[model samples]
Target: MGFFTDCSRALLTILSLTPASNRHFSQHPLALQDITIEPEKASPGFKCQYPSLKGWTNCNGPNSRDCWLKDSASAQPLFSQYDIHTDYESVFPQGIHREYWLNVTDKVISPDGYLKTEGKVVNGSYPGPLIEACWGDDITIHVTNYLKTNGSTIHWHGLRQLHTNEADGVNGVTQCPIAFGDTFDYKFKALQYGHSWYHSHYSLQYPDGVAGPLLIHGPSSANWDEDWTPILISDWSHRSAFQDFYVELGNSTSGVLGREPTMQSIVLNGTGSYTCDPSTDKNCLPQNKRKPIFSKVFQQGKRYLLRLINASTESAFVFTIDNHVLEVISTDLVPIHPFKTESIHIGIGQRYSVIVEAKPSAPVQKDGNYWIRTVVSDGCGTINQSKPEIGVIRYNAGSTALPTSTNHTGLSTLCADEPPENLVPVVPWPVDHQAVNDVLNDTFEAFVSNNVTHGALRWDLTDTPLWLNFSNPTILNLGNTTWNPEYAIIQESYDRGYVYIVITTQAIRKDPSKNTHSVAAHPIHLHGHDFVILAQSNQTYDVSATPKTFNFNNPPRRDVALLPAGNTGGYLAIGFKPDNPGVWLLHCHIAWHASSGLAMQILERQSEILPTIPSLDPTRKTCKGWDKWLAGHVLDQDDSGV
Candidate 1:
């Protein structure tokens, strides 16, 4: 039997063998904070407790916030047996099951006081509902695509789908898109914890609205009095992303060549105020009909854990609240030592879990309100009608007036990630020198070229721009002797060693005229594993000398990191163990660039991938449904099918 099938049978046996009394759900005693366990009706034996429960002092049980699983007396923490040094590739707790259902449909909505008829939403909300679970919990989500004319697939942003490649949910890589009126069940284990967002991987669907927050609760490196739900900040446009993509592609007759789409406004938690001109646009709502500014009520003297995520199409933001110093606790899903900063730069598709004490820099104001700013990073991307002050933080719950607070001075304006030294992982996993040498031997150059199809400009991470076939995905065509060159597959057959990938933007072309080098920084995201950033620099990489500059001792490890821009000859070197036997995607998280073909596939342990999948029956069924629906549709494959 396959790994998933064996897991299913084992789960059934465990559920059936446990006594009825022992299956009763109960919250742990340390659940005094704002975090609460909300089990679904289908999950009968679901039990969740704060990881730092007082009486549970054993090494096998959940450790305290300040304790590690292997060394309970130490200050470093690991969740139960899944601590920092634990080999999460093969070992993880088999926690309770959590089930959720999502319905995706086309709807007309007003997010920033401007109506967009081409909006694609999940469960009738612009920014979909939060999907929460504890670490190691088996999560089953049934996603139904009800869109009248589109195929969809939902990708859980940073979850490592260990041994379960089919659940990764990339449309053209893992599986086919869910056909209209069809429900696809995605089952996988929550191996990593912390907050991330789930969104449609079908073309440009996520930018229109098909997205939501996903929080996998677990132990933290620091303590907080209250935990807030994920705060999603994004650039909102009135027009559909599909229409905006035409401008991005320079395909629209009215659009200028190679121009990025200009967003209309900024939205925080699905609400914003747009300066709508009703005289020129009928879709603009009146002042009284618009939604109020996004705000959060803070209790005095209490520290709050704020999960910050940037879901923008192209813009990078500097997140800050007026007069509040953010004590950053984690980068993406990786726990880090606490560091204080006035503001943080958040790249698109990146997440940060920060602790902000209720104490403001100055004494409490008469209005007790402060502005939450999402400032556009300089040299990043642009928003036409940008509003830095998009939200508010109120000390008084009764206040409805806007904050008169001033902007935080000395905020960083550079379009770069936070300092690498400040993002030190709490639990260090040092890299091997030999592994770094092995990876540097095979370097991948990232560059923009104009020699692609029809001589169109495209960004490439490999030899060619990735253009995938919707009908025949990578998961179904594994173990093949050859692959389509357009698929951009990088094969790594070994299963025992670490895979280090060095991506540099300083690729020198034979014909100088064909080189379309870009100065824009890319937020690179890897699908299957959280890789360590060995070295990142704006200087040109020297294959011989650069190896000495790499930080082999516990570098910044995360799913996404900023690959510096090409103006100064940039490069990003990252390393991850080849433990997950799957065809994982490594791509730029920028919506325009990803759809413009800046991506590649890492086919790790290709020979062993087929044996892990118990059945392709469900995959075949979904593909058949997609093919049948596609036959009657008139949609065009304009860009990359990712």
Candidate 2:
């Protein structure tokens, strides 16, 4: 497990990697105020409150105050559904396009126990509006450009985007973003089902709340009765969350490009901790009718499934209902053998569905109050904070006990109990998806060397040239070690004109920069699919044994990794068939780093190669060329310069 306690320092140290590579960015500068979204709702427990959570900060990386950190919002109608038409687009003009807006104000809601978005949705809905359709249903979204920027596209989070390559909505590599104000209609036949999301494929606009959920409810596979819930978790900061780090190192190093944040909080289903509830000052929301209230009633011994979605932009957490254990059944969008555990650690973009059982015979906890516990932590899985968000799993307040009421904990454990003869089918599934069969794969690793002499130097992911050995980064000037135990980002670069996502500080931060002496462990996420952690030199990664195991068949999938500073760096083997074609984004999931410059793009399968140009009519550009040639021969007047 790699640990990065001081994200700012780490980034500063790492910036020594190649400050010159990012020199070009100094030009074509974009202002912080120009960032599209402002602060409103940051995250679950970290509420700044309206009047106090004001300002426009830069989007450096996660954990940085530059986030325009969320101030917290409590509006009843979190998300409202609305019909919208948009065109699928792709943009890759080297900063050639104008700007646009996603207006996080569009809001939408998922059925079951979900926290609503106060604003930031197109119509004010979290996950935006649901695009409802059937397996074979064809849906078209006509995207209307509203920003001054030209290049942009919308990537369907979980959609195949297989045959509809152009509709893949990737910028640059797939298709050019529609011209500012131009409209592109995205048409696709609904294939699979289940919980999914959508977001801009152009810039950091996503963290600004430019993303939304896409749910496709298909035929129920398992004949279970109850409904499902999505536990979406994300890191939010209203102001520049990493600015403090940036201020320290200044020009000497890459400096912490991320914004520094003031406070960090965890939210439950999008709401603040029910821990105290409507009690603490403004922290406790006022008693209102809009608060979402959901209940789960089941027969004793009967089975119910709780589909959990760890949608947090950052943070790897454990979800539990105190008394009840969660059975691991499915992950991401794939099904696994039903395995039960007391608690499950969920990382961003990971999903799990467990069946909860209310023991008909077990005595119910006297009252309806039940603890919904979630633990946020450091990479090694340390319990950074054990937050208990409370909820009720009891009978109606005054209603008399009916003939039979199942256990108070409406959920069930995955072990010991065998799911019924049939289990709930994984929703919106592929015709015949086979992730375990893909054969072709690859892996690599390296170390970083530092320049402690001047408190600076360049580093790389390989021994090739810029790598580093964090444990012994090197000796620098005045005994002022460039390799502090604190700096989270060991290196950062904008080398090829593209932002290469580095540490997702806001995604996970420990103490204040400068004051803290611990290095940072950024949680970086890639867009398309999971990647396998191969190997790490220095302390950059963690490994189990000499020779790591390989999943010739199937490997665990994840979007982020916590980089360490020494020899025993962690390594994981992840593989996903590059069946879906288009430009796929492979960068750090951290919002702040992604914003500052810790991001990059991967050009996947080439677009459909076409034959030589088909003939054009006489009035076409080709014909005009012939006309010009003839005129050049017929005129003189300084060679017909006019």
Candidate 3:
């Protein structure tokens, strides 16, 4: 595509050097305006409500029992949608089915050609819709929000919603928030496989675009050929990640420390180019009509399988591909042990399945078109983008020309993660207890505080800032044994093997008279366990020299990792094995630092998690349909009820 329209005027002359953002975001309380996007069709004779499952197919008829109408009307391409049987360990002996109806709404388009900004997407497309499944499958999806005033959910990110904690779609922690004409459905179980992504944990609605790409297939530490579809590397925002979470949480007259809203471009799957700035006046569209370009088509020496997703709501990418290299098999949803790299650091809500090897070597490259980069990681934010934010890789599918190659020179813009001994885990997993001498440990310390009472700027772990209770949900007050220690409870109770945890971004001080603590790095995430990463460090931790640099043997487990900030503090030490009971959510996958709270709340085995949830009547009928839309609407609930 003319090398993405000549890198879209060199990425809009580098987003015209930022400074003209905000084109009205945060709408959808039904003030609904403009609205004009169409083309998604395919509800034909729809109907397949679990009709004997297994790759479902029925299409109504024969005295239709109204099977909940959901025909994808002959659609395809999510890496062949799902028949994935490469047998790397193949074991879904049957009971595998999948479905999806999705829909959600709002869209104005212009994914990076600067400012069109309306996004919320899905079915109206935008980074949202590539589901696919197969490892112990049994997924379902449905969705439907039509967002006129926002109230949606969808979080399957790193699913291990084991006892299906209300299918773990957090928005007030599991249930409630699918209201704009509601339709929920989720159903879980692809049990631990390879790729991940499916966002919209409400509040700040996944960087104003919900989000997608969520493969499952099964095993792989090697072997490739063409498994490519799921590359999402976001950071875009002309405005409205719920108004950039009020410029990163600052209200009371914008005083209490809130300002991390810089980004205006760095998309990849949903294209990118953004940069209007005729000096300002925002509302751009001609750069050859928002120059989209996420082309792929590799096939030279063949080895492909690149699932890389870093669905950034707060960047931290680093993935590269110029003279291709990356072998790296699986990370989120574990299955590692296959190294080789040229780049592959991904963090905001991580996921990696890399295995490139398309062999593109050539001279001063002309048409083989490389430039896949992503770079951005000024410790996870601030992406001005002069270059290395690209996406093209086209080993001649009748090239459109561009890549002059080069750009792999001693990289280390210093943001960490992907070096827990190169993430080893081809399924070993043996860490028998001991997270810095675990006596059922549960320590934390992440900071960024301004005493957080009314001075606003909160992001804590200790001086409490969790604040979630949307119509009372701790899985509907799990038999309330009186608990709300700022919801930082870690109540485990068996599955005795590990549970440790000990995060620590050096105690406080974002300027406690300045001694250190403005460093960033914290892609923490952990819901339903994948934990183990005993000891990541920038050193300041010293309970006798950080428990002798703990790593109880086979460490490196996944579901997001990367604590490292530094000055003199950033230790991490995780350890999971509360073998999936429920009410999980260990957070920090920064969507403005987990809505300004940097979360916590394990509660596993909380009295055996509601008798191992098979159904709590669809979670109390979706919390009585979110308490009948919270008794005639009024839900803004500031941030972090996610």
Candidate 4:
């Protein structure tokens, strides 16, 4: 039997052996906050709070800082707390073990030069803590929530949760949000290797700052002398994400629909210069602290691997380094054939790994610095970025001067995906011609309209916004006949066959009399699977003729892809195998669009999933905690229940 099968049988045996008197159980007391790590030592055995629970054990490890970096002559070798040293070959061999503890909390600070704003951070740091592990390692992360107000959950972006769906970390779908002062353990194997991020999946929380980089060490397509930490590129706003969400979804006096709030600036690695209006603002300049510039020191003729992640809530970005060429190696978590490009386009929640050779033949200014530019793509949204969204790449380590390096001319400002031909996966996903015999083709129309009953503007996948029951996650609702299918798309017994879905979006006016309508591209993200992009085009999809144009042989595979929303209508055709049994979410990565209800659920192999997850006790306990909290407190369900 496989691991899950054995686990299922063991769970059944344990339950059957237990006495009915012990059926009712309570959670362990609030997890202690002191997570300091120290030298290994054994303590006297402590009595179990719940002796009836067979596998329960006291938490170990001295409570110290979870992530830290050591000073180096070249640069700070970035790593998590437990990883004092790392060797790629040994750490990521054929198989290995990895674990971490992440504490989620709220802090008030200005990542940029803007006024102070409340940020939901992980491990007491903005842009959260870095989660580093080796490929094929059995990764375990104990996430403790201390948000004080909102519950939190972290989604490890682009990591195919495989059969371990509960570890997907999507609140309201895979599991309930970890309640304040509660902890949830996420365990899954890192089967794929590349760079991505873990961010709060709870509604509007990630944009408020609960996010961090996740890197899985493995083989790279190209050689590099050193690999720096992942660079996070994002759009910035002065107000909280929750506050901005209200403007997009709230009742409007002006009758305009789908107006995305203008962002204050663009941020690169949580640092930017936001021009503060001193006349209108009291907290103008924060005392004695300059916005820290993201800097990288380079030695001539050496190659550096830079992992780029677009963690923006809405915007797509075009990233370029002044007078430099980037050798692109991977997209999302899929390693691709290396291709050279001057710039690369990245959408929200997407990632790319590229190599840069710091050759002395390149431009070396008197200042010894070059600007790393990230421009918000056109048609995504508007932002008041008077200064460029840039980081500094210094030729010398000791140089503190700014660069006069100029951006490359005529770079494409359009919000679109990289050429499909350039993104061929190094490891191709097999396409079975006979698999289509049992295909489930789903078509959804994307639209923006006014919710007449609620008196707010809303975006729809197919006229319904996803409103999940926090107290009853879909994973726990397996085999539930009473569950509604309005927002859920059910797929069963495909095993390893194709499940095709095509999403099309067109410009639609809130007021039918007006010719103008909201039209912009959306970056759609899928949980639990890396889907094959069969076709993506700005032209309208014809039911009969579109299938002929589909790429059946080794299509571009990724977890996130752009669904073009143009005047003529954009369509994205994607296919994935239903080998992984779990409840999955497909949603637009745009904060505004997803909040307005442009999303859906896929319940795959429900019967199979039930037998695999025989012990639903932890899941039940979480639901109970959520239920108790909901009974006493009122949570406004303005946004989609991500």
**Backbone Cα, N, C clashes tallied per candidate:** 0, 160, 8, 6
**Per-residue lDDT for 398 in model 2?**
50
Superposition error at 128 for model 1 (Å):
0.7
Q: Looking at model 4, how many pairs of residues clash?
A: 6
Q: CA lDDT, every prediction?
A: 0.79, 0.35, 0.67, 0.71
Model 4 C-alpha lDDT per residue in residues 135-211, reported as the tens digit of each score: 44567799988887788888999887765788888888888988877888787766667789999889888888889
> Which pairs of residues collide in candidate 4?
35-63, 35-64, 36-62, 36-63, 36-64, 37-64
TM-score, every prediction: 0.88, 0.52, 0.31, 0.82
Stretches of candidate 4 exceeding 4 Å from the true structure: 1-94, 250-256, 277-280, 360-363, 433-441, 449-455, 507-517
Worst 10 residues of 2 by lDDT: 80-89
- How high is the lDDT of residue 448 in model 4? 62
Ranking by lDDT: 1, 4, 3, 2
Q: Write the per-residue lDDT of candidate 3 for residues 399-502, one digit (tens) a residue.
A: 87767778778987667887888887765667774533343245677876655443466787655778776656688778888776666666777766776777
**Per-residue lDDT over 53-170 for candidate 2, one digit per residue giving the tens place of the 0 to 100 score:** 1242222122221112121232311111000100011100011111222432333332222232322333354444444432223456766544432223566665654345445554
Evaluate residue 467 in candidate 1 and report its C-alpha lDDT on the 0 to 100 scale: 90
C-alpha positional error of residue 443 in candidate 4 after TM-score superposition, expressed in Å: 1.0
Candidate 1: regions farther than 4 A off: 1-91, 251-257, 436-441, 452-455, 508-513
Q: Which residue pairs collide in model 3, if any?
A: 28-148, 28-149, 29-149, 112-273, 112-274, 113-274, 114-274, 114-275
Candidate 4, residue 125: lDDT: 79
lDDT of 4: 0.71
Best by TM-score: 1
